[model samples]
Target: MPSREVHTATITSDGTGFYITEPVFYAEPNYEKVNYNNYGMAFRIQAPPGAYSVYVKTTSDAADTIVSVSGMETSRLLRGGSWDAAKLVPKKYIATARGKEWTYTYVNGRDYLDIEIEPNKINTPVGVEEIVLQPIPPQQREDGSLPTIFILGDSTVKSYTFDETPMSGWGQVIDAMFNPDKVNVINYSMGGRSFKNAYTEGRFNDILMSGSIGDYVFIQFGHNDESTDEFRRFGRGSTESMYETYIKEIYLPAIRERGMIPVLITPMSRVRGNAAPGYVYTNSFINRKFPDIMKRSAEESGVTLIDLNSESVKFYNEIGVEATTAVVMSIEAGETPGKTNSGSYANGHPSKKIDGTHYKEALAKQFARIIVTELVKKVKAGDSTAAAIASYLKADVRVAALSGDWSKIFPEMAGDTTTGEGAYYRNQIEKLIQLGVMSKDPLGNFNPDEEMTVGEFIRCISKLMNLEKSTFADYPNGELSREIMGAILVDAYHAKFTSKPKYMTDYNGTAVVPGDPDYDPYMDPGSRGAMYYPLVSWQQLMDTAQIAPHLASKVKEAYELGLIRSEKGIARGQMVNGTELEPKVAVTREKAAKALYFMWVLQQAVKAENDVSSLK
Candidate 1:
């Protein structure tokens, strides 16, 4: 294979070779200084098929430094001293400049060479001053001894780039589960590629041409295959029958032709509402039978099968919609950087809108753990193919210790066994606590009968939906009024999903304030204003100015999303011209839970609807 000259390289930000952090906040020139306490820096090195000696010069206030290339186990740790002593003893934290060298044979592709300074493992920062590369001799390179595991699937399994930081696929993180010295993982999965397009686009060919004889190929698809829409792959995606045929006939046979082992994995599930029952949430979606079809195909072909769909569903459902957002790419407004369908935030932080389809690094690692754990089980049951892969798994992954259920994973979410509540909204309150939205005081009392303050409600709702944490920093004291609560709920929903509510302004452009004709606060004739904005849209309540200016938009959105219903406590201020949103009436904790329940239900409904529409 051809090799490029090894030299002291300048780290570029945007090209084929560069250095970047995991969350990708910024890339420093030459990668000399790093501010984050993380194992996130990945530097790309261009190399050919040969063994090489890599020399890295670095100093740190941190206690240790670990460096490893792709397909290699990281075992060496360069020990240092604490930076804290520098305050009293000057130069105590100064970097001990030394060149540490690691020798490894070059792997295929320009993969990232990761330098991990164990995150939170050290309290101080680390700096890498230089990296020098030198090729040893052709004789030193390992000659196709280690078997490679090539991953093929959609966005859920593909490895992401620096720009796409924080978003990782299971294919990318699965490497961590394996003993790198035993196996090499090369992810060929691409975003939006179904069974048909993956073959058509020569992704499969890339694997066949590049991989050795005994390599393993993991095949997973179906997220985009069932689509009838022309937007994805210009309608080249498969139908149900087509998907089945491609898997059993074309995909399996082709892998066998290349003397490769084929492992089939069903597609994972999407995020749904807490209101959805386990059965309904797990099984309901466009082409929901895809998993079943995959199971049947695997049996007929006598291929090793991993049922990730069922496992992932159980995981998402147990966690609930609110908890699931952490793993998926559901970006809240101002969380990182604002992202809407139209454009990005001006400040330019990394953020995305409410994305249910893709997995963040957290979820990707979880799913990866689940997949490997299943393989470990198969090995124990005496499956030859699974044994081949499971043999290479890290010691911890060799055991089936990872649980798909959230409550088992997080004990606090299960709630205190000794305490209980007897309120009418007891179930709702319990669910909220389980979801980490609400908690008990020192006395173990939820105090559900008492009125919920505006500040309290804001914090609970924000935590429940994983909205921008600082969105409502102005959490005012005092009981949240019924109308204000409605506004807050709708506002949070919009901030999360980015769905704008419909509205219109009068042609006369009148600045309407509170206490007008229909909004007359004290029921006095003089309190009634001269002009009134007509309730043009039922989606838009007539007199929004009647509420506080800060809460006016949310109240309008509440009407638009149908979150606010006109009932006894929730009143229409006017008897004739328009509905009056009762702004002064306080909402108790139980009533707040009811409103929150409606909002949660709406979240799942919208997701399900979107899932169905995507199929068309």
Candidate 2:
């Protein structure tokens, strides 16, 4: 058998360090053709700090082998070879580093090794390793607070373990946008279960028992309830009748019994038919009965109704069939399975599959805003007279306008006003600027038409808002580099404004040869990725102004609310220009008009709700 030799070298700033490497086997052996082996070779090396070691461990497959290190030692071994078992071997080596340089060599066959060293004078883990598991405690629910929401549905509302990847149920996202301290949310949903099962199997009862006075319940079903297969189907009318039973027999009685409120939600529509343009009621036969029955039930029960199906349809229609499909589909092109890819359709269900019937976190958040808007409206007509419905409405409008962009909060500065700019966003920007939360640049130019640099854009908003800053002497120039905008970037990162990748180029230094053995082109700027940065950005600024962090807690609060994501698996610092924010993006005066007009409308809605409540 032919074999190859490999060698590796390392250098440390201090004289005390270690070096380790593995040998690469280039030849492919046909295990099936031959009785390859009953055993595999293993190598090990142990050394103290200021010493070096090298070894190789082979596996049947190269990918299965891993190189790892322990304190001041190194080793290599093969895994999954035709061999059934192998004895653990230990080897020790000693070496002297001239200055800070160390080298290692190995002969032939593929193998892996890991190296470890004593804590160098300069290197350390990034802070203490802490894993926070429990949900952050909700802020104080003072004497007066936003109405608590209880969500009850099926897989469409809550996902199954099988459906947890890539897409979380809409309920998860809905729970994120509100202040937990003010609005307590309890999502009681199970995947593959429907309204009938929920009530019969004790889920609904569980919610009722947990309910408190002044709380609100939002109920949506039909996805699983409408399933026609005998094995899974709950029967169409049966589902509707069960819905009625819950409203009259369960929901109403519980609410009235406990002085809580009920809000009926029509089942969100499902995406069906490949050739047809968009999502419709799952089957026309059942659709007519479900929606009408649910609507009537809500009316008869004197409960506020939110037509989620209708709203979803309208919103999808506005975005067009393809865009809507992209929004609903489970998998987008150029994505791997098991990884949550964008554009929805991973499974037949809404979240995992990216179909019209379900929503991804982003869209679920929007839907939640819609539901909250209606709920607030209803609350305004009751005893909560001081509660501003406008706040809810403004939140919806702002979220819709921002579409996840924080920078759009300042319309006068974002400059999205254009004849073609959608009225939705235009109005949001105008209101935000008017509210004095955002402003234009010093040049009297909002630069509404320009793509914002990471530094310029993050810093602009950071300065506008009084965010925290850090100074590090170890950073470039004995001070954290200003050009990199580390201060704002770090703050944004902490606040979840931007995401960094697992591996990112060291942009602070001059570019190195792409293929150099010593070159790690993908070095992350920080340990965490950008998706964790919750703060809004320029593209976000162009969309909605209100979702932008207005207070210090808003940043952390937004993170807890699930309003932001972090780049957990990717690399960072490769110049993420806001492709969505085109340069010279002229803002049409009409767009501005639409924004202001909507803000007025939202404000009026709030005022109206207040008035109604006062009358009560």
Candidate 3:
């Protein structure tokens, strides 16, 4: 039979894949881009050559939405359908969030699935939320029952939506790396899930219920387990404690009893946090104690272990720090040129902020290859367990090298420092550029004297500290104010230090200010009846009405910490008893560089102190 040529139709996308948007011949002739109710969307499923059933789930805003297979004479009602005819199977329906499931059988391993939306009289916009492609196994096993590989991990291993494009998981593409005709791959991983939460949420139970004997279950976690706060499943104890309580005591035994092979994989390292200057790895989450705990758990449980942490660290280091941004979900405003489903993310949405933890499609595919390649290596090393799963890999599959000119990742800094050899900030600026803490403009000029904005300053600090999930994208690119910069410096300080900074603790001063709640004009003769009130603490001094209430205390802390330099030759409104903050004044690039240097120096002092404590 000849295939249908639907090239003239516009393509509409679901979460992970797209479908053709053909005109709804039965409904209005016009294809409404704003309201999809007047159009039909379809996608052809291409799977391995075999007799199987395709299960689809869809949701729409309109009640009269129809789902039917090709070659059908009339559209079936959403309520009921014949099993033999392959029509709509109503799972459940709600007025606000209506959903339905449909099943279609194919003997030729392919079929055209179409979703038809009709224009509703109520004028409510209609759309399809999700389309899940579930390929049902054949009734009879021809090749001795092919085993399934189950993946259990965090966001780095879960499938992402089309809107979340460029943010893919290794598991999403791992199946393609293997010979699909030989085995099946199912990913049970979810974002923001720790091992404790996953097990508690019955995710493991779902896998055990569906898995059979001789199947492989690959487990990886530990992106969220490091949280110290009570929320997000915190206080679940340390990494070692969680490993012992879950893997050694429970999960491994359960899998072994079920006769399924369990393979433990260490979570991959983050690009920013793990990349150290002149080193393969830094002392971040992966390098600290988590990977060691994973290794110990695998060793004691006698499970096949894959050290993804070490391998990924090596990969990031080889690619260099600046190039790491290419693989991860790090994009500056308007950096990527594709239109998202919402159309808002194109011109620099907040979601486009720097993400060091997640991987883009290219790196995700590479990581999948690395996982399979490691299994192949294990098989070559004569590991019987790895040998069992090595047959599923495609012929001669190898890890691909991350290509691109590394030198071009960050253009050379074009600045003249020869005339200012004695200038203090020149060396500091050079160090910042070399460390990848700062980059030159697209025109290749460092522009050291250019006034830094709040966004630029936050980014520089974030890079220096390797802060994950920095949420300063909304900060405007206008010249940064001293007061706002003070608040941000305190944030950076708290990221590393637990106690109050030495400067804040050492300060002892009081000030007289007006408009205080405790102000009594006639109470003190020293006030001169000007409604003056004594500011007893440094916090009170910085908690002026001009600053936002939430940031006022932080600004005060930053000022006392000596991170904020008092302005010289200040105006009348800026000076308070010869202590001029000039809080509203724009910070120059030179001053910003000096402030960052002070913060870095303080961080080093804390690090040195901690190192000495460790020695003791």
Task: List the candidate numbers ranked by TM-score, top first.
Answer: 1, 3, 2
The TM-scores, one per candidate, come to 0.43, 0.39, 0.42
Best by TM-score: 1
- CA lDDT of 364 in candidate 1? 74
1 versus 2: better TM-score goes to = 1
Superposed by TM-score, candidate 3 places the C-alpha of residue 290 at a distance from the truth, in angstroms, of 1.8
Q: Model 3 off-target regions past 4 Å?
A: 1-144, 229-239, 273-280, 286-288, 335-344, 347-353, 398-616
Each model's backbone clash number: 2, 75, 0
- Candidate 3, residues 254-311, lDDT tens digits: the string is 5665557899888888756233345444435742377778888888767898888877
Under the 3 Å rule for N, CA and C atoms, how many clashes does model 2 have? Answer: 75
lDDT for each residue of candidate 2 in 1-616, tens digit (9 for 90 to 100): 1111222232212223222222222222442211111111222333211211343222112222222222111111221111000111111222223222332321101122233232221222111111111211112334665666777777667632211223346665565455565566666765666654554334554444445556666778767766543222122224455555545654466445544566678877665524245433333325436777778877776667777777776665555444444334343211111222221111122122334455443345446656655555555556242143224344644454335443332234333332222222332343334444334565533433343343333333333333432322212322211122223333444453243221122111232322347634244322212221212232242422333233224333332222222222221112121212121232233322222222122212111111010001
Comparing 2 with 3 on lDDT, the higher-scoring candidate is 3
Best by lDDT: 1
Q: Report the CA-based lDDT of candidate 2 relative to the real structure.
A: 0.37
In candidate 2 the C-alpha lDDT for residue 79 amounts to 19
Displacement of the residue 292 alpha carbon in candidate 3, Å? 0.7
